[model samples]
Target: MGAPARKQRSGSRMGARLTVWASDHGRAAVGALGRLARSRVASIMTAGVLGIALALPAAFLLLLDNLERHAGDWDDGAQVSLFLQADVSPEDQAALAASLAERTSIRRTEVVSPDEALEEFQAVAGMDDALAFLDENPLPPLVIVYPVTGTPADEIEALTAEMGEHEAVDTARLDLEWVQRLQAIMELSRRAAWLVVILLAAAVIMVVGNTIRLAIENRREEIVVTKLIGGTNAFIRRPFLYEGAWYGIIGGVLATVLVEGGRLLLSGPLERLASLYQTGPLLTGLGLQGTLALWAAGIALGLCGSWLAVGRHLADIEPR
Candidate 1:
């Protein structure tokens, strides 16, 4: 009988231990969740602010990326137009094209006769009647040259200068304005992106900090009681840290949703704009990497904010 009783008592002890363990974990989880849910208004407000802050920078980044992609595809075929001298014959222009085509840097060359140039100008300028009234075509023949891929800019410029110095070539024009402007714009966008990221990060920190401060104020009595009952500072701080983490996680998710929603909203209009310009699809919004970074940032902000709050306020709240 004694042995059976002892076995029953041991089983009861095990069951009680299991129950207590389960209850503590459950309560802790509930406490963390409840704390977040209780501050619904504050949580939603903070999350919305974070979403807007993240969205602005993210939209700017997407635009910058698309612009860079378009710039990168700029026609690598550097154009060099050689205007023929007034006295240069059609045969002479043809010979020049053949000669330039033999150079390794020259991918292709073509000679446009004076009559063809006049017709092209007339069509483009919508002045066919004006051109017909003239006794003879005033436009000179042109030798247009295109360089192969990997042709250095300096080499192209030198080639243009050499062509312009020729007896039959009156002038040579190379359009390098596109490349210079694209490069400048890309640099400016890069700098602006960095600035946006910095400002957004500071905004996140402030949001988390304020949230943690409010949490501390709400839980002042709980913290005081815990300290009085021999609960370690770490144990008391654990739930607040968890609260911060929850804020970060929720904020990150909210931001992602906002970003994706904005992308969907703009996609149709963007596609239409691309079609009008005869361009391929343009990418927008945060990609997988960006999404992951946002999540990590939110979690880090939460942890840091909680740490700062507990470290500063907890020390001053010790029970006398």
Candidate 2:
């Protein structure tokens, strides 16, 4: 009799555990589904709004990235032209080119003879007829210098100044002003991209909050009955929070789709533009990390918006 009683007690404990587990999982699943059914139309509308909002900033960021890449190619190949005086001998010009090339900061240097320089100018300027009447070619020899990667602008400027002081060098000019302007523009675009993202996130939260507020108003009577039946505030809030989360997850997915679709739509025009400039293709889509961040941001906005709505309205519908 004692052994039978112990066996029955063990069976009862196992059954209790199973029942608790099943109840918890069933409630979670039903809460999610209930939230979905309660505001299907509102959820869809909010998701669409969020999708469009998120896509705008993402697309702008893609455009900025492509522009930066195109700018980078020109920056990496920054050049300086050293014009030698006509009195400087060819041997001295060659020696100057060799000396500059030997410097750690200088990547490569080439000296162009005076006659060759004249030919190049005439060909480029389309002024061969004007040049034929000259008694002698008046162009100076040139030393073209390429700086090493990651060279500082100040250092390059100093080097140019030093080169200009040389008796053999008539003029020295660094071609880096355009690069500086491009870098400034890229920085401005980056800041603007972030600002746009923040605004869009706020927009998403507002949309979700308004929709949840309407839901609470519609279910005011049900909430009152739950309070009378002894349901805790947490129990009443769980389904609404779950609903907000669902909206966020779905909205994130939709936003990503919109961003990708927009990229595809613009890719052809962008390619044509790049071809005109002889540049590599511009990067136009979010990377894995960016995509993940976007999804998480959407979900968080949805959850916070729903919480705000529930907190503001739930206490008003008491047992009375």
Candidate 3:
């Protein structure tokens, strides 16, 4: 009975201590928020800087994503033109196209006879009088081959080379230079965006740390007095950590707002541009997942910055 009673008492004490700890944390968090509210202008200015920093990379990445999506739509137009030898018969050209169509890499093949090619050139070039002087059509029979969707650029190039080697084909031309250039630009933009993100993240940490350090300096006397009264470092540190967290949360929210606002502003112009190409909307904003990640990143940076400031500055403040 005595042992059981002792265990119960111990449990109660532990629960009481936990409740006190949680209450203290809650109070600290609320108090820190109140302090920020009291200094609206300064807090807003600091958070505004952070928001701009966070939004730049986020916006760049979002733009890159949208461009990549638009580029994918362009991929459907990528096709290889296989110009057959002049000597190849119509039957042979059709048979070659049929064989290429059956391959896994080739989606489908379209055959254009020499006469059709000449007629198309004449229609577009308006050179009927000049062509009438020629006894024979100059254009060879053509086979246009479209690769499977989502095929790699290298694979398409390889397929082009393979098709060019065929006996009936004079040359295989893949008109994908624009697509390749677009992909290269996308890769470069992605890397540049990441670089900007890293640099801005470092800037955010430094800004938060400096801000927290100034705060600690302003409260030097209070901290010293608390220490003299037997307050532990952890207890003194709680409110400052909360202050940093609040800064981060506000900054993250501001960043989201800025990004969305920018997206809305650009959406109209982007839609107009996409309409010229008969494509769908080209602008995509930071969705739910991205917004949450931005918030999480801000919070983490804030906590880290504040922890560093508190650990360094708080230790220097001692009861004298």
RMSD of candidates 1 onward, in order: 7.5, 4.8, 2.1
What are the per-residue Cα lDDT tens digits for candidate 2 across 14-133?
999999967865785577767776767866887788778877887788788777766766767677899998888888999999999999989899889988888889889998889999
- Writing each residue's lDDT as its tens digit, candidate 3 over 208-290 gives 99989999999899999999999999999999999889888999999999999988988888889988978888887789999
**lDDT per residue (tens digit) for residues 1-320 in model 1:** 69999999999999999999678656765798797788788778877777677667766777788777776556464689999898987778788899999998888998888888887888899987777789977888899998775565688889899888988988899976677676787889889897988888787777777777877888889889988889988778777777777777877888788878878988999899989978887766678998988888778877787788778888888787
lDDT, candidate 2, residue 119? 83
Clashes of 2: 0
Error of 2 at 253 (Å): 1.0
**Best-to-worst lDDT order:** 3, 2, 1
Which of the predicted structures, 1 or 3, would earn the higher TM-score when compared with the native?
A: 3
lDDT of 2: 0.83
Cα TM-score of candidate 2: 0.81
lDDT of model 1 at position 24:
67
| Residue runs of model 1 more than 4 Å from their true location after superposition | 1-31, 75-78, 84-111, 129-136, 145-170, 228-236
